[model samples]
Target: MNDSREQYTLANGRTSINALPKVSLHDHLDGGLRPATILELADSIGFEVPASDAASLGEWFEDSADSGSLVDYLATFDITVGVMQTTEGLTRVAREFVQDLAADGVVYGEVRWAPEQHVAKGLTLDQTVEAVQQGIEQGIDDARGEGKTLRVGQLVTAMRHADRGLEIAELAVRHRERGVVGFDIAGAELGFPAGNQRAAFDYLAQNFLPVTVHAGEADGLDSIRGALFDGRALRLGHGVRLAEDIRIESSDDENTFVSIGGLAQWVKDREIALELSPSSNLQTGAIAAWGDDLQDHPFDLLYQLGFTVTVNTDNRLMSNTSLSRELSLLSDAFGYDLEDFEVFQLNAANASFLPLDERQDLADTIIAGFQSA
Candidate 1:
């Protein structure tokens, strides 16, 4: 799926969606590595891969991730994290990750990954962060040389099943002035509530660090509640399940009557961003309550209710998509137009972990891009 060459045009034929400036909020570093890069890095580390060729390896990843069960889908990350042990491998993968995002027309992106999973090759926590920062800087320079301006920040993540929450939190705060911008918790979200990482959340809160939790994906409103009350999360990663809190009483051709639950009201009133990744949600069964198709996803309902909904590609390689493609898919499913697309971009830009001034700049860039489009 060479999505870089795929261009989507609007019905008006006035703009190519791929050329529009975009903001990526929920992308994963480990999950976005190039298939060829993974092969080369794995060979360098003498790590055995399931497939020998790059094409086959790419298919293998897509197949492995397509499993409906979350556990089976997560098993695929073992291979990616296995090869990302050394500093060189991490740096190369990070660098190419930015290059790929730049080619996909992402002007600003937050790359999330769990550092604890990359300690197999004996690199210290600080060293691993430094290595990834170096690669991001190199990738930025490369994008500049190619006449594309891109900025990326690291959203340091802690595995929910791991006991290193406070440790990873401190590491993120230590690197705040470097490339790290925020903190997140990912993994099985159903059983491992954000409350389990109270110490880390406390430390991050006292330090005034921004947080986003992987909630409302594999779990329900209770998990989202924990993310807000315990994790103090500023954003919800794949908070698609928050739609469960929205109860529809009746509807007509003119309007739909609905009632909002307390949790849903707070999230909507507070304007917490929902990182909705359409394809990934379908593959992971996150929207199984609604249906197995994009059209059945609650993304349209949430957007209609003004939930600060932002489109994303959770894992570009695994989901085999990009932000542009995600936007295209959403537009196709929900019959959204340029105005709706621009709203999604603006929502992501405002919800980014960057400083207020930087976020303002990002918004300005998006406005300019859409104006020209």
Candidate 2:
């Protein structure tokens, strides 16, 4: 029940994963609320919680998310979202969200959230965005006050199942200078294809907003194709299912032959980063085809094949994980050393939506951080 991440050390005791500077590309805002905060906020709003205490509530989220049912997993958000219906709630949650990421050693993080979902208490979309920005800035200053420095950007997201895609897209573009860095679509990726939000995608594309689609997770190749072709996604969220297009023809003692389809070829060639969340993938059954364990993940395969794969914690509260813990798990399963961890960090840095010069600077930060470690 205690899913809090402990300090993770590599097989070699020389370096600690917790001490590394990392970039988190695909973390969600509503999905990362602290349990104790959730309890207090729910009380303020007179909403009932499933558990009486923070630890019990945290365990409930982790347990329900691991049920391997998207329906059950999504049901947990009803509680978190319930608490975030006010400016105070949103600011507190967003501020604490950054503090949590900074504490986990995240140097830069792009936190995504669907603003439309948080307007149930009569908050306009713009008000919600401002409230969250306020919290983010406060959290950054708070982290610095404690001698930790972190930068955060907002990725305004539209729910794939909702009809306000275009509205959300405009809101994101409006806030481009106010911490919003990118746009995304998340929620039921199966029937609600990215094509359903084509108008929004087209709007963002014409406006030159960077986009990342929640593809190749709940659906297969066609869904991924829609994300790239229609959604114009600069990156793929939880692209673990992109493996469906790859066919392993043969395996021998000395060699293994595999063939890739055109889509996979394009993704690899374009260097579009795959925001892969190993623990969350298993919890949601996203990687069930390969097997039900971390070892069965296609991360190493993708890495070896030269695809831009960056690690992430899709939902820290539900998955009960941190960025350091995710890296540590990958290291344990793949026998990765510090240099390999550096490569992963560098991969995330290069794939981030920062301006080219800034992205390069992030890469340099990772390099310098790793060198010192």
Candidate 3:
């Protein structure tokens, strides 16, 4: 919506990363709404927005989110969730979300959102899921008509601080056959540990549902440990701070020695994916311990250590980013080549919540796209 065509190019002028196939595993449905769409939806619902014009509204979201305070950053979601309280609003936003992903060359995307946050307009949970499914189907059809094939699935989320985890987990399982692919716990990751939702995780585990928890972003190793042990999270949402587990023992001009703590070792040995969002990590202070620059991110260390690291745009609207822009920024910060970019996409494909066969298909798609490029 913000001329992403101009924003998503390789740093070294290698190629247009936007044209490469990608997998989006940690994106947020509520956080990816277009500014114009938000304005229209808010107007129809008589909701107040912080800004009147589309551009100003977009800037407001970025600025609010960039305030470096988690509470301040999360306030931007109030306006988005306010507008997305109806079936019509949810459907339109979901449809455009898919279209935007397709336009950005995302072969597959998992749109995560807290359904509990969207119940203000009195729509039942089932109705909200169905509305989003309808929009996803429409988006797929639209992409097919335009000779672009893209697939999207919903990752139903339960707010971590809320008491609806068990209900939301059941809702995800009930709709798994329709459009839902996975479960996640989001919102205020500091004091709200995943252990509080033990019943939900237990239910999901019994039902064989995959989960990715938002940990290690606003918290530390204890939170990540809870996500793995209590939530049984197959992946970590913005688990960038897991780098804290690694201690740089020594460094030289040629190489640096590091010691991986047990937590980092287990994550690596198990091949659990870290859904690292470059821009959002910076905006949310997830990488504050490392440094205040993109180059300071531990993405390189994690990648070099064979962590199953994957790139994502956690909140495209809030961060004013896309998957392509994320890859581009990583390349600029770390001097990564096309092969490195391909590996990130492949890692994402392998880590997708899709079944094994579909994951294989996604990997093949990424290989073909990269080969062509």
Candidate 4:
């Protein structure tokens, strides 16, 4: 497990970040597996791993992912996805995923993974979804036993570089009533645009299914434009690069003047949440144009500009981070406090795939938790 998973407190030490209610919208299922679990699963499948012990293996994932390239960062998934080709592997990893989220104080989470990737071991798409749903259910029960309440849903993902977009979208709609809450297109964002999956997006639109697109991370504004125009995304995963559209015209001691592009204004006015993962964004070079440090991230700028920004851990093991750690890092970088954190949780809850009533209920729970804390 990541050492960052330890409890984090506000900068002033007034509140415990781990004790605050949070929501995670962009976390990846395969990317959040525990290092110890990876070792066990790899051993059971006779798969070769780079390290023998959990600590070294965890460090290997973090170190390898530190390269400032999205492709290089994504290559670390080969080891994680390699051992998750069977029902046992999928179920166990998923169960532990929720347990970890609960431990991190995430009251609601959406776990996204490409089902097409897990069918390499002969399991059908439906079977893989079923196995994961089973694991999620068990994990919920386990959390309840531990005196925590966690509600999680699956976000079925299609590989953008592959030809299974339509199939994966259909699978997601098929299981909407079971456990799959929404659909997404992830992987290799530079070359493959969401428009490439036009048929799948059309079908999802016709079905009234919510969609979140991975845009503005590896690619630029054109990719994000395609995601908004063609994919009809409800949220933008790691849309940190949308900051590229905002131009600073002039700055003063008291007030700074800037111009927002049409696209940036639209996303802001529409309240489309930008799922911002600080450490992962840094690791993948998503924020390189701005700077190489957390303080340099556009997250504070986006928030100050009235954008719907939600914090997330895109990949826990790879980034060696958790939701609390992400919040803690942001707090330290921007000097945020409890009120700022509460707004972030509220944004995520409102942007979640859950129905309107449930979202309100979640917002209420978050407000109550923060108030009590």
| Highest TM-score model number | 4
Q: For each candidate, what is the lDDT?
A: 0.91, 0.91, 0.91, 0.95
Q: Write the per-residue lDDT of candidate 3 for residues 181-270, one digit (tens) a residue.
A: 999999999999999999999999999999999999999999999999999999999898899999986556657678999999999999
Q: Candidate 4 on 249-316: residue-level lDDT in tens?
A: 65566676889999999999999999999999999999999999999999999999999999999999
Candidate 1, TM-score vs. the true structure?
Answer: 0.97
Clashes of each: 0, 0, 0, 0
Candidate 4 regions exceeding 4 Å error are: 1-5, 251-255
Candidate 2, residues 16-67: lDDT per residue as tens digits? 7887999999899999999999999988889999998988899999988996
Runs of candidate 3 with Cα error greater than 4 angstroms are 1-4, 11-14, 251-255
For model 1, the run of ten residues with the poorest summed lDDT? 1-10
Q: Compared to the true structure, candidate 2 yields what TM-score? A: 0.97
Kindly give the stretch of ten consecutive residues in candidate 3 with the minimal lDDT sum.
1-10
* Per-residue lDDT of model 1, residues 61-159, tens digit only: 888898776777788898888989999999998999998888888999999999998887799999999999999999999999999998999999999
Name the lDDT of candidate 3: 0.91
